[model samples]
Target: MPRTQAGDPLTERTIRVLDAVLDDFGGRRFAVRDWTGRRHDPPGPAEFELILTGPGSLRAMFFPLNDRTFGEAYVTRAIDVEGDLVAAMRVAYTIIETRVPAAVRARQLRLLLTLPRAGTGRPRELRARRGGRAHSVARDRRVNDFHYSRSNDFYRLWLDEWMAYTCGYFRTDADSLDAAQVQKFDLVCRKLRLREGDRLLDVGCGWGGLAIHAARHYGAVVHAVTNSTAQAELAAERVAAAGLAGRCRIELTDFRALDDTRRYDHVSSVGLVEHLGPAVWRTYLAKVWRLLEPGGTLLNHGMTGKAGEPVGSPFLDAYVFPDARLMTIGATVRAAEDAGFEILDVENLRRHYARTIRAWRERLDAAEAEAVALVGDRTVRVYRIYFAGLEHAYRRGRINLHQTLLQKSPAGRTDLPMSREDWYAPPQR
Candidate 1:
């Protein structure tokens, strides 16, 4: 690394820390050490600069007290990555492992668990623009933009080749994301009791993963709805490619626009309720209630809260997912009942989510460079911290995930189905 021109203490310390971390990683990976200041065969500045300035480039952001603030700033986009995001992540991880002692790391972890967050305060500018109905024309567009508007290239880094943005179903320690996503898709299909010629509706479909799977594997006609325009277009293209365009349709709209005249035999939503906001959970369930045909089954796969209401993670609200809310199992069940759906089953896959998130974060760490090149440093940092924090939360049991099976009663009876023969994969254990 080059010497600080002004010999400032913070800059000097940062450079030293960066160098030490890079050196350690180089030792582990047996990769060449590329330092700008030290006498090493480092990557050329022009090459490094290109890694930063080109599309998908990521620049590293260094801070004086990473333990104190990096996590929150990343969530807020307060810290930016300029170029070569993957390299930046490798560097950051190395710095943490080498520059910070184990004792300090433990202390930081404890602090994170106990620290209170700032009040739920939206930016003044954002407050000025609060629109009616969280998912209204303006607010809906903003929510879509907050997530799907991100670069496909950026998503490609951590997500499976199919670009599944929902949770994965881990069957074994050896199952890769490619296999796990397939597993998850099959699981949902089985749980919903999909049958040939059955019509299915996917609410909050992300890139139409579940819809495409059902139509292709189960021979079901599918209609999918999403709030993101990017997802709708991509899903349409995928459906057409699979020659399921006739069988599956992707709609770029909200659930409120659904025509009540139409009903599906099967319904599934994955990881979508988080964006529904706390105030609308009941209303959203009512929409689901009205969308399902009599005797139809609805599968809601979402992350749940261990406790009702907020824990005040301002960073998550401001940077990661704006206006997102999590509901406890008790509240979610009541909401379903209020919508007049009988809750036939509730399965908590909390541990699976912990493993799933770990897998995702690891994959993101591995593909950091490609991600940064696509989105830039700030976004890369945002994802890294977000993934890490989420992993911690899940492992600590502060959050939960569930796959609830709800049914719209035909004769107001819950004992219609006796055979669960096809409702699950063979015991993997």
Candidate 2:
């Protein structure tokens, strides 16, 4: 047990301030331990413990008063969470969302102001640098580079064998991550009704997993586009190694800049819509529609928020995704309809995403030493907390994953397939 200020006793005023904050927290299952070895246990069983390292810890975490500030405090080790990180994040999210009385808030602020400010050491990795206007091609490229241009070896430490970064489709909770990823790719192919020599366009293709899979399995010729130079290089290598050089073309270019002369029989955009920002949904969908031939199918897979929830958080925007935004399924469907797309099917894979992220976190934990060697401790910590928080959000219905299928029907003509029987039939060996 560490003592605060050379064994100085905790003041009554300090206890009062802590109590006020915890009272507003209700009956969350967590414990708090402040400096001087004082513990404030919850009314019930605790799933995690938050340790405040010094008298200045609370001030450092709350005085600046924003999610990004608190996040920086945690990353710098002023405040630490032990055991059940997902549960701890749930409580933290609730605290952020809760509103306290004005009088109580003022009193808490006064108490916090009296405490000394803690010294936070330099973090191993700095926060992402912001630049230019949001959603512009230059700005979007910067954001993509910030997240995806990190060393491919670092990502390979935990991602599936194919380096699929998006959600996986699990047949059951017991399915392995690799198996579920394969299932997800096959699912996309079946939804498109891909056939031999059919042309497929993969927008925002990460590492060329789905593109190679489609060419190898369904005999489809695929064109995949990405904005990250790192991803494009690795994907090109993977495509060549898979003997798909003639069938799959990997382009290091923005999806918006694709030539309009080319048209595809099927299009798939997985895990890409979140970065488009809400204002660009109409433009995004219109572009996809233009790239598809009449009677063509398009499958859009991405994360979504609840109907009335806001799209982005300051902490995530600054530390993690930087300008990424989420939209509700209702909003996405409306945008597609407005772009003259006929909705065919909508499926929510929220539960599977929860399992998928949990698996990633576990694998990353097992390879923590290797990850740190690859990307430094600060980057590892950022992703650790991010994956845990995302899993909790999916499990609690705060976020959702949707696979929406749409068709471009010209003259009320849609291609065949009256039933989904073909989707479930076992692949021919």
Candidate 3:
């Protein structure tokens, strides 16, 4: 950490640059606390404050002026956020994307040059570095293991009773996480119109939440696949305990490895496509198409992003789901159409997902002690920030959750009800 001398030009320049950027963001109601306990308050009511750990924190925060930098600053404890992390993140993002005059930019560059280029290193065991080509079957397996295999007990701290890791469909503000998750599973079942004795394929299934629900409630025989060892074991145990062992099979295998000869009445890929990589979108859809019986429906649920946006912050791509990429809904639909499937429906669950992440964030924050005990301090911190950032991303539309329905219409035949009322209506007694 460098010390700022009294009356130093860098000190004045840093203040000036901060003033300019804060004004550029319309003087957002956030404050900043320097290492010396000096306060830089905004003009109005404040929701959060950024506390710099040392003089080098400024360097770590704005040296490159990117999402990864801001995220790394917090993760490394170079800067700490007190109150409203999402609000602070919004301000940081606005400043990052805000344009300024050439003169102001020059001053910012000068101040950045005067500060130390590095911080006190990163958080312990924070970065996840994987070798081999991105999205390769072997690498994808390792990536899934890195994220999903970090102790099922840790996930139990935050996720719902079913441990449905993807977005949950919240019908209203009063929907509990557990109920919403069940609704999400049922929503998938209804969209596919899953029925008794129907063969279902749940690819990239996390803990087999959907499989168990589909079998127990809908009487669908499900073959769920996952690349995670812990998930497969736990999901199988849950399935057996529920007395659905004969109906639901949890297989620890990549979706690509499934033999095409074995087909299914419905293919539901929730939270799986993002990892298949954009280049393989065509082949990925084709694989699902081949595995589905004629007139069978496929429910593709996953995250999406607008074109030209980065897949995610560098911190996310490196540490979480390293093989994942978010393609826009349009591209996803086009790929499905190219794979010989008729587009049935595309519903954006972005708002519901925001609510879902908010619940997870609150639950995780409440169980921070248990999470830290189970997975260590660094893992807990990483995930806390991850959930917060994700919630902000979804709320602000930087990303979205799309549940798309497609069908292999044999000779232009269809099985879907005429309206969405059947999908959302209450169950019959």
Local accuracy by lDDT, each model: 0.66, 0.84, 0.82
RMSD of 1: 9.5
Q: Write the per-residue lDDT of candidate 2 for residues 1-429, one digit (tens) a residue.
A: 112233344543454566567566664456677766666666677799888887778777777666666676777778888889898777767656557788877776787888878888535356678689988888888888998988899999899999999989988768899989999999999989999999999999999999999999999999999988899999999999998999999999988899888999999999998888667878888888888999999999999999765567767787789888898999899999989999999999999899999989999999999999998877888788888878988999989999999999986687667988888675775
- Which structure is stronger by lDDT: 1 or 3? 3
Model 3 is weakest, by summed lDDT over 10 consecutive residues, at 1-10
The candidates, ranked best first by lDDT, are 2, 3, 1
TM-score of each: 0.71, 0.93, 0.93
Top lDDT prediction, candidate number: 2
Candidate 2 — what's its lDDT? Answer: 0.84
Q: In model 1, which regions exceed 4 Å deviation?
A: 1-133, 308-312, 414-416, 419-421, 426-429
Candidate 2 C-alpha error for residue 188, in Å:
1.0
Predicted candidate 3 versus true structure: per-residue lDDT over 1-429, tens digit per residue: 122234445444555556655665565466767777766666666688878777677778876877677777877788889898888777777767667788876676675777765556766375666799877788878888888888999999899998999889878788899989999999999999988999999988889899999998999999999999889999999999998989999999987799989989998989888877677778778888888889888999999997766666776876666767789999999888888999989999999899998899899989989988998876786787778788888988989899999999977788577888889975653
lDDT of 1 by residue, 34-151 (tens): 2222222243341122111111111122223342244443334433343333444344444443555677555544433332232322223321133567656578667667677777
